[model samples]
Target: MALRVDGDSPQNFSALFDLRGTADTGELRLTSPIGSTLGLARWSPAEAVLDNGSRTYRFDTAGELIRAATGADIPLDALFSWLAGQDKSVPGWRADLSQVDAGRINAWRDSPLPRAELRVIFDTP
Candidate 1:
């Protein structure tokens, strides 16, 4: 994913991920190029935590956990929708699911200042 937040330089990242469970309580695992685990984020209503092999970090909510890692406020609810092929709209983000079947998804945000963009590539079972 490549993200451009209005005032800051773009942030780019690529990984193999597995997101399981519901938005309220789930696990998001990030893997490296050679298929090694990089980080694992797990969240519930009361708390969110990330175990990165070496250490662990904690946050108050899933949103905070995401922001801390990606520097964006990614609504988990909307994310789940897109993953399921729903073109659901959010206040500041627009998603292009046209190529989802081809293993790609693109989304961008342009509201509340510090505009941002997100691109994802995945494999479907």
Candidate 2:
């Protein structure tokens, strides 16, 4: 994943991730390029938790956990919808699905200040 925020330096991340279950209840594991575990996150309606080897972080809602990691409040439901080939509008973000057929997606946010961009590429149909 790559993020370019207006004032902050661009942030680039390369990881193998596994996301499963629904938007409200799921597990997200981020692994480094060399196959080492970076962090593991699990969430349910009741709670959200992130284990990063050295420490654990907990929050009341999954959104909080996500925001803490991404520095943006991305809607989980919208993300899932996009992965399924639908364009779900997000308040401050725009998504380019033109290349989705080729396993590429581009999204950007310009509202609420600190414009940012996110890109995702996958190797699957």
> Relative to the true structure, how large is the alpha-carbon lDDT of every model?
0.83, 0.80
TM-score of 1: 0.88
Give each model a TM-score. Answer: 0.88, 0.88
RMSD of each: 1.7, 1.8
Model 2 misplaced stretches (Cα beyond 4 Å): 8-10
Q: In candidate 1, which residue ranges exceed 4 Å CA deviation?
A: 1-6
lDDT of 2 by residue, 11-123 (tens): 55556777788899999898888889999999999999999999999999999998787777767887777777799998998998888778777888888766777777766
> In candidate 1, what are the lDDT values of residues 14-69, reduced to their tens digit?
77788899889999899987999989999999899999999999999999998888
Task: Report the poorest 10 consecutive residues by lDDT, candidate 1.
Answer: 1-10
Clash pairs of candidate 1? none
lDDT of the structure predicted as candidate 2: 0.80
